[model samples]
Target chain A: MPSRISMRFVIDSSVMQAAGRAHPVDKRPKRCRGFLDVVYGCNHRVVVTDEIETEWRQHSSRVAVMWQRRMRTHRKIWRPPPDAIEPLTDAIAGVESNRREQKLMQEDLFLLEAALAADKIVTSLDKEVHGLFRNAAKEIPKLRRVIWVDLDEPDEDGAKWVSGGVSLDPERMLGSSHE
Target chain B: MASRSGRGNHDSKQQDAGVTRITVAGFKSIREEQSIDVAPLTILAGANSSGKSSMMQPLLLLKQTLEASYDPAPLLLDGPNVRFTKAGQFLSRSQKGEPGGEFRIAVQLGTNDRVEICLGKTPKAGFGVRRLTSTMFGNTYELTPEMDHDAVRGQLPLAAKLADGSFPEEVREQCVWRVRQDRCFLGVEATHGDGDHWATFSYLPAEALSHELRNLIHLPALRGNRGRDYPVTAVGESFLGGFDAYVASVIAQWQTEEAGGDLTCMNGDLELLGLTWKAVTRRVSDAHMEIQVARLPRSTVGGEDDLVNVADVGIGVSQVLPVLVALQVARPGQLVYIEQPEIHLHPRAQVALAKVFSRAAKRGVRVVVETHSSLLLLAVQALVAEGKLSPDLVKLHWFTRSETDGTTRIDTADLDEAGAFGEWPEDFGDVEWTAENAYLNAAEKALRRGMKDAK
Candidate 1:
């Protein structure tokens, strides 16, 4: 049974682009597709920032586009204003020092900002950035609250978390909710 | 013209002159109150029998009532714009077929003023106004029948301000009239027009509202008949009937004017729509005139003398003529409600009509269109994306009927800067999507089968 508590999640463009591919051919895309289905069926909202929306429009397939359009109709798509984005981006830049990690952070930091703006939940396929952000969470208190999920990995299960109402589990979360 | 005092001076800002929003409740297929914001270019789209037309019917009812020669009923059930025989024909009914008690209609002006009128069936089996209320410039005024129903009492929050000569002079004069005269049926005053002038001012808001309704122009789905020769009728002070009926006479009137400016613009629009013909009116007789269209010369050497009667051309041209003419002659602050502007034209021509509607909205004519053409709507979206029309000036309302109760509900959406709707219903353009997908899937399947057979 699906949990009654609805969650808001920021779905990275990587997952959306793969979910849009032909479903019968690949195991990775099929998992991504199944995660989105579970997310929608459980009444969880999909959050997008301006940059995230632009990326989805450019790279996502027709399947993802149709899903997003339906989400808009159901009022289940949240577009949080950029009130906290610019400052948060600046903060992320200041916390990271390595040149290579800095470049990756700059590219994926928007997902964190959007997640912070909505619920502190993000479902992404980018495992490299997920590892980097988990390492950086030690320096930033706000980043500690982010709960990252990677459906591409064999061990990670997205459908259970979504159907269970995305409860605060320390194993899936970077750190504790309290600073 | 007596004392015309207390006439309210609304804000004359170009952006704030037309109707801004409308609300309807307890009307046919609309059991609950539904309100929609009116933009410069408003589109109403939905499935058939979803109450898309019912939402705008109240405005047409008021227009026809104000245009009636003699005041017979509070609302003219059967008229030129909309036709119905009895009050029960339009009143709301329960799921079990029980009729509702009363119906309410409200119009909100761009100036932030709102007027709401309620009507019910009277003892004589005729529709009568039960209550009229208006909120103007932060002041509220109401009128209703007295205890014995013999006299109508006025309720004004700023009665002292009205008596102190602070209100506009024209509104004061407009409000002061005999209640029983029925000249201003919207006022519903029963105070026998004695020396008590303040009692009459309560109806001032209704008078102003009626004036606004009278100024509205409507073009029904079915326009005037196509005829080779049109009789020239005298232009009335206001719209006496359907605006479509006055299209030819107005064209003739423009021909007699100094510049014939609107006629030239109308011809240009006709050409833009790919009609490839210019309309000209000839005075065949004193009271009769004929409209002829000449095809554009294919070459410079070709003469312009080859003219044919409008009736002889394609029916789409004559049907769209009235819509073009109405847009050309309309003033900036006026509202022109048209149903199905793309009736018989080709898809390309329907797309061209979007440009015409966008230009008219740019010129400050509030245009409300109810249509089923996805081509026309897509063209409007393109115009917004290209920055030719502001997304802020456009609003789209989708009406959906509840499958369970058969009542209507409206879901409104605004276009983003990219011309994409913020919230679009699933089935809005799903038929086209479904057809395209089906065709693609069929083609792919056939190709796979052919390759296997060759192997």
Candidate 2:
């Protein structure tokens, strides 16, 4: 069947690297690749900022490059320029009082900027940063609507979410935690 | 059998005769020897001026030389396939301002048969063959010009075999080499062992090599534009070198023969491409005809006009018709090199062209495509993953030029079962991403400025 809906997504470089490291029996890499394949096959676009592309260049495998080529050919790789992350970085740092959590958000700030630039959806393999951003969403208005998904874990049901065309379920948004 | 000119042995299993690899050196951007392994579906891709055409031009040069009306002075510098009036025009130039010292071309047919030739400037005669080496019938031979250039000296290991009595004694003196006027021989008599008797046996391999080179079909990038009138040609006569000249005639021939088999197939492919029109040819006279397109009968509704001259419709249909005809009429074991088959096509139609190429390759025609369309490449990969085509049949060569030396190098990649290239060249097909980022940046700035005005 064709895709139900086309959504723009910002996938973390770690997930891309995992997808490139495919295995015959390992479900982790399979799910990683499967999520991406579903995302591509369903016509969803991938958002890549300069930071994300840099990470991809550093870590992604040949398979990921091939997938990226397909995405580019289909016009499904949505790359927004590097936004002024300083504003968002200051906002997150102000909201999250803990230094470690502030550092976590700093490292993954590009995801928020990229997602906010387009559809506000993200797929990542980083669990701690995913949780810290969700918790900080209460104080940060811009990060509230960001949808954080981890394909490596079952809590977010990454397989089911991606298989379902990545619909923006209210429960998956960071703002849902505050509500 | 398909009546299309240059098509022979329609069976896919007969693809054993397809050209396997081509090597070009000291020609244009290719200063070093660059080899591309030709597959059933070979794709040559790179940025503009990265030497993609240089790889294929060698074959075209050979084809035009063989097809010329008169004997060429070794190599035909100007011809229908590729045009160059002088040797220095095409010879690779160095940054230091000197021309390449040597120019060589080698083509491998099948697994074992190979032909490699070197060209040199012949004083007043543009360029001529300096040395010829061929491996045919499981034996290798080298031929070079004698001192005065009146005769060619051949080193045939088969001669040694003949002397050792491994073969029949009748073959000993049967080796003969003669130059015929009607045939485009290299214009030199070849002799082995300082004797005339050992000459005749060498001509078979050389003739077979020439036949293969002559059989190469090149459809240049620029095809004929849409026209109301197309000329009719003699029945079953082929337009081998003139790709556009053959479209109308081939369509006319197919419409009259084999129950319109090729015509029906072409219409089906056009429909699949969302073209909505069927190509129809009408003979206006014995020597002239017009090719037109009519809306598919099923697609017409509400008393709409069904027929229109091909020139009246969108140029995309006209531009793609020749490509469709070329692929449909080509037979297995035949090499059809098309440049930019996706030109003037929508992204969807360009993707559909991949299916056309895949089908042609599966049927045994060696399809060599030079394109800058990533959509076409993606479509071919999708076909492999869908099981419509095997990965083994596809070969991709990415041409990249050195920043410092300006010489071209090829990076070859293979497709796996999942349709992913085994090795993806760096920064290839990334233009879309760059454009996307640029557009997004502009959009974001516009949004921020609009917000400032609202405040």
Candidate 3:
């Protein structure tokens, strides 16, 4: 049998915030850390853009501040495994569209460029920004886009409902409540 | 191919006298004359089995000629040929039996000197013996006698000693007499004693000639399994040292101008990110060592710092550094062949590689690359279009297979400064996306609909 194709999901801060997870105290944002923990442990690789970190610092500063406060109480919270934080300067430098939009899009553009460059499925929860990413994906070979709902939803039918922005069956979105 | 037009702006003051041209004859499916000029940046493209690999054969052949130890058997023949009709299996065609099956290659090393190597198979003259003649320069040399022993070991010394002994004592003393001069005809008997006899004294100088040829670095294509076991660090070290010297020269020009605040600060920040001036070292063990960006301690958080052992860092940083290190370490007068440097890299990083190749070319390293990614191609095209690299310095060959012969044909496309080529084949951009095939499929569907409507 052919080897199964492996993929990576690079998450942005906006997607993390939408998941309602507490921000990570020392390193990446809370939702990002949770998403990374889940994805990294699985067969798939997970990556975060410097842009995502910068955005978390700007739009999600309160989360960062909260994490900073928590870190004071828990000194161990600030440390990350050496392999976890990969600086994407070279990957980021390769993106032409990102360079063109550096002034206007800032960190978000950097994250988008990283997603496109990574040649893996970019997982984001923001519907508004999907078009820009999808268009960029069209220009790049092997690049794709996936939403958080698609990732969390167990079945295609359940994913369809969540993707349509409906919460008719909360259990489907949340998984088994008995557990 | 039609004549191409365009004069790219000279980005660097360094002048390229021009690339050395290689001509191949009777190699594989390439029955006729084939030539490829190794420009600063040369791209070989063609459809499957179309002579893209054949064009590269000369390089391999040159390597085989220069490297005395490499076995040349597997490089000569393709797969077994068989013909099975309703009748049954029959002995198939032999590639060696084809018209002009004999192979010859002439490599222009420089303006003044060129080496032409030829190989031909002759029928078996006697029991357990086949005649093979290989000629170097204008001198006709036969290898049939030496093939029983070691042809390379036996013949190389004989050829060199013969050439050397032919030189007159006075010319030998001068040490710089041209071969064309009649005074340099040192007799073969003086070196080898007599015809067909291996002289004892001839052994030492032949060994020396073989050593010189062995020193030539034969770069292999990325796909081959043979060189895969070669340490990545060794390749990285060579590429990095060459790349660093080139980058230093390019940066020297920018130093004279007053640095703009935002740009300088941004560059400084990027330098802190460990994109520039990072050392790469390989441990005796399998571990790869590279300088990487890391968060400073709480007291020195804002201060710039570099952490060693890049492999311990994220995959993106570790994976991308190899290309930079390779480019940085490439030396002048060396051939750097890379296959798909864009693999696992972001588009931004792809653009960075383009600049890296451009900078390397300016410093005198010849780069030959094969890529499937358009983004990477576009980035290089952009550099060419912007006049950062000369149009003549870059040549792109598109390969397509001939339907009749199943042989690949290569066509050259010239990229203008705007990254636009004069003529793009219908199947050029994407192999999966074909307008002609799509239109034909649509027409077939419409015709079927008309037939159904009539029914």
| Candidate closest to the true structure, highest lDDT | 1
- In model 1, state the lDDT of residue B2: 17
Worst 10 residues of 3 chain B by lDDT: B178-187
Candidate 1's displacement at residue A62, Å, is: 11
DockQ of each two-chain model:
0.08, 0.05, 0.01
Interface RMSD of each: 5.5, 14.0, 26.2
Query: Which scores higher on lDDT, 1 or 2?
Result: 1
Shift in Å, residue B10, candidate 3: 9.1
Model 1 lDDT tens row, B1-455: 01212122212354477688989998899989999888778999888888888988887887787788877567877888889888787788999988887888898887779988888865654568766677887877666533223233335534435443544555543443223323224443322233554443343566666766776778888886657777777664355667866777878877776776767777888888887547878888987787877655131245466777788878888889889987766666578888988998889889999998887787777789998898888788889879998887788998899899999989998887767775455344455544433544455566667778888
lDDT of 1 by residue, A81-100 (tens): 75755446677777756989
Candidate 3 wrong stretches, greater than 4 Å: A1-179, B1-19, B25-31, B47-49, B61-101, B120-279, B282-322, B417-419, B424-455
Q: Give the Å shift of residue B310 in candidate 1.
A: 1.7
**Span of ten consecutive residues with least summed lDDT in model 1 chain B:** B1-10
lDDT, residue B331, candidate 3? 48
Error of 3 at A6 (Å): 49
lDDT of 2 by residue, B139-215 (tens): 77666543332232345545444443533566544433443222223333434444543432324335655666666
In CAPRI terms, model 3 is classed as incorrect
lDDT of 3 by residue, A1-179 (tens): 21123344455555445333322222222333344333322334444454555665655533333322222211212222445444444443344554444333333455545544443334554544444444433443322332223333223232233233323232322122222
The reply for model 2, stretches above 4 Å from the true place, is A1-179, B1-15, B123-126, B147-154, B157-204, B234-238, B296-298, B301-305
Worst 10 residues of 3 chain A by lDDT: A69-78
**TM, every model:** 0.69, 0.68, 0.44
